[model samples]
Structure formats: structure tokens, C-alpha cells
Target: MTLQLDAYMHEKKAWIDSQLPLFLQETSIPGKLKESMLYSLMAGGKRIRPILLFAALNTLGESEDKGLSTAIALEMVHTYSLIHDDLPAMDNDDLRRGKPTNHKMFGEATAILAGDGLLTFAFQIIASDPALDGDIKSRLVALLASAAGPEGMVGGQEDDLEAEEKVLTLEQLMSVHRRKTGRLVGFPLEAAAVIARATEQQTHSLTGYADHLGLAFQIGDDILDIIGNEEELGKPVGSDLNNHKNTYVSLLELEGAKKKMADHVDRAVVFLRKSGFENSLLAQIAAFILNRTF
Candidate 1:
């Protein structure tokens, strides 16, 4: 199953990698800004969010290509977030995907502008896509905006920076995790649901699935930070410890965190089953997230 999933993931990732450059090519913005955007954008990651979007659309019997524009937009938003997250003002990371972070390659100023360019360009892609209805496009724009805006990923990040050295309770930590990771993970699935005009029950189930899956994914990340190899992680390990961040592993201990992650994966699988769609691919994705090396 791992082999098959790997094959499928590689195929989807290749497709996304091939298409991402074309989107940057459409930008009329002159100068090295485009180069900066493409630098981090093309830097390799799992491409999980866009793949989830495609898989979710497929589960609903919609053509996977129907979600392509939105998928690209989500990737842009993701890349933009990473670029900013790695800034000296933020996490101050030195490596990403085994390469120098955007700020390391480009100057800090150029990196900031590159993040800004990609972020706004995401909206343009959504607005310019001819396939979606006006109403659908509007809703999608609103959803993506809110997910990536102050109340979502950015807000979570702000809290994260402030929460350093502060011992948070489980609930407080979960709140941060939900906002930081869960919301973005849920965005593409929810968008696919909306675009497919899914049933209320179907949407609810998929939302539940995404919530659990996102939590499990984050927990897995926390676990990996303690035990994962830097080579495979493409970054240094013990970052959470070095930063004094209160992670699941810190609060729950290694065994406890693993158990919690397993529980979330189980609950996610149950929700996926409740969706009543042929979602084997999504189920596999949840499993992969829980068990991934990076």
C-alpha cells in the first residue's frame, strides 16, 4: 500500500510541479520578483494540500482538473506563508526542502516582496479562471482569504510567536494547532466540497475528516521533530525544543503523543467512511500523513 501510495503521490506532485511554473509565467510584474516567487514556489515539498484538493474533487466524481486553479492558488498561498515564516522576523529557519530558504537565496527585502506577489497572484488566478461560476468563484475567494488571513493561519502564527516559553494547557495548545494547521488543511477539502455541490452530510463528514486529519498531521510533525533525521526532514531537528515551544510531544510525552495521533487518524478514517463516497485515495492520504517521514 505504501508503494502504491508513493507512486500516486509522485504522479500528483509531478503534475503540480509542472503546472506551477506556468502560473508564474503569466505574471506581468517585471524584474526579479517573478524569479524570487518561483524560487520558493518551485522548491520541493510534499504538495499535500493541492493533492488533497484534487483527490477530494475526484471523490465527488468531479473532474480533478476542475479544482486545478484553486489548487494552484492554495499552493501559492502556502508558498507565500513559508517564505514569510522563514524570515528573520519569524522562525529564522536556514533550510527548506534541503535548499536555502527564500530569504537566504534572495535578500530579505526581495523575499518579502516575493511572498506578497505570490499571495496576491493567488487571488488573480481564482478571479481569472473561466471555468467556475461567478458565485462559486466569489465564495472560494472569500473562503481562501479567511483561511489565510488574520483570523486563521496568520493569527495562529502570531499566537505561536507570543506563546513562546509560556506553558499552555492542552486546550490552548489545541486552539493554536487548529488555527495554524487545521484551517489550511481543511480549506482545500472544503473548497472541493463547495465546488462539487456536495450534500450537507457529505460536507459535514469531509469537514470532520479534515479536522482530525489536520490534528493528526500536526501531531506527527511534533513527534518527528524529536526523532526524525535532518537529512529526511530537510531541516534541522529539535527546533521545537530549541525554541521552547510546547508541542504535543512535550505535553504528552513521546508514547502519549503517538497514541493521540493514532486516535485522530482512527477518527479521521471513521469520518471518511461516513462520507459515503469512494474516498480510498483520501483515506490513504490520511494514513500517509500520520506515518510520513517528513
Candidate 2:
């Protein structure tokens, strides 16, 4: 049977969303802090990272149960990044997922704390899981930290900030996003490979798939910023342009960006085929990135 991507996405997203609050509730955090954290964490967005983790697990013939904590932790870290990225000193956005940003709703201090809390708590979730062995936990913790930390997403953010208002070459732009966006996107696949004990050749292929998919994702986002509906996106469109940010669209033009995104999607699917996951949901997701509206 052909997999229904929408239904599959909705199911996975629902599962991730349901688990997020339960994990938060397990903590003995202060009431206000907890509330602030939950507010942003529960805010609606496509839980793509977690879904990707689950999808990777499925592709590896592993049960989704094995990746539950990892998926939740990934989402928590992603949510934390969004909360901080929307802060006054950052993107300074007012809307996120169609509601007031965390800082806008809960004040800057609380938002900052909430982001910090989520980021730190993510590692704890992985570490404290009784189901995962110590070695697995250690590996996950190291991988997650590296993906979300100064050498990865954080470093990419620094490059992005520095490149603002200045034109960047396509190579430079790719470098910035590879760390900031691609690393996290790639993390799910790598983590899944670790969990499933995938062979080195399989891991290499998945890594190749991830690199192209990550670029496709960013290119799609850049295209959406130019043409997507504000209501559908929940956040304002053209914010990239307003910020004078160099995007795939800005650097390559609208049609050029679209073509570039399509190329990456094609390459991603080829890698999936090489990894023996050609017909899996991972391939569908690459196609989704090619035509995503949000």
C-alpha cells in the first residue's frame, strides 16, 4: 500500500505532541516556569525533526518505540531554539505558530529561562530514560549536544547573524545553513542509525540523504517566505527580506531557488535509494520538502 504522507505526518505529530507535556509534567519545576515552557512547547508547528527520527527508525526496520524519548528530546531542543530565536535581541518576531511569541507573551526573562530550561531538560530526558542503555544515552547526549550547540546550530546562527545585510556567496550561505539547519535535520537520521546499529555503508548513505534534504528544506523555506500565505505560515512572510537576510531566494532569485530546492530533493531521494530506503517515508518526505507550503 502506498503510504499516505499526510496521515502519517499527522499521526506522528500527534504522538510527539501528546508526549511533550507528559515529560514536562514529570519535572518539579516552578509553576510559572513550567507554564512558560509549556506555552511555547505546545505551540503548534510541524514537528518535522521528531517525525524524521521516527521515519528513520522505521526505515532501519526498528520499532518506533525505541525512538520515543529521542523524538521528544529532539522536539524539545527544536522548541527551545524557536523560543530563543524569537527573542527581542534575536529575530524579534511577534508571531510564532499563529500566536504571540514566548517572549511577547511571557516577558523576555521568562522566555529566556524557558528556552534554557527546555534545552537543558532535553538532555535529561535522554539521560534519564530507563529503556536506553548507558552507552546509547551517552552517545545520544553527545550527538544532541553537538547538533544543537556552538559547533552546530549555534555556530550557524552566529554565521547567519554576521552575514546579515551583507551578500554571501552560495557556498558561504550553504555553510551557514549546513550547521544551523542541516545539522539538526541530519541528527535524526544519524541518531536512528546509532539506535538501529546500521552498517557503516548504510550510515554513509543516510548522511548523504540528510545533507541534501537539509538544503532542500532551507531552500523551500526561502521560497515560502517569498510566496507563502501569512495565515498558513502562522508567522509573517517576508521577514527574511525585511531582515535583509541572504537567502536562497535572495541569492539565487525565486525561480532559481525553486530549481535548486528541486535538485536537492532529487539528490536526497537518490541517496535514500542507495541506502535501500527508496520507497520509505523518508523518500516521501523529500518530495514533501519540494512542494511544502509551510
User: TM-score winner among the candidates?
Assistant: 2
- Cα deviation of 167 in candidate 2 (Å)? 0.6
Model 1 bad stretches (over 4 Å): none
All predictions: root-mean-square deviation over Cα?
1.2, 1.2
Worst 10 residues of 2 by lDDT: 1-10
Q: Could you give candidate 2's per-residue lDDT for residues 1-294 as a string of tens digits?
A: 135888899999999889899998877999999999999989889999999999998899988888999889998899999999998798999999999999988899999999999999999899988877899889999999999999999999999999997999999999999999999999999999988988998898889999999999999988998999999999999999998899999989999999999999999988888867898999889888887898
How badly does each model clash, as a count of residue pairs?
A: 0, 0
Model 1 agreement with the true structure over 1-294: per-residue lDDT tens digits: 367778988998999999999987766876688888999989888899999898888788888887899999999999999999989998889998889999999899999999999999999999888888988899999999998988889998988888998999878988998888888999988999989988999899789989998899899989999999899988889988998888999999999999999999899889888866535788889889877888
lDDT of 1 at 89: 91
lDDT of each: 0.89, 0.91
TM-score per model over all chains = 0.97, 0.98
What's model 1's overall lDDT? 0.89
Model 1 worst lDDT run, 10 consecutive residues:
272-281
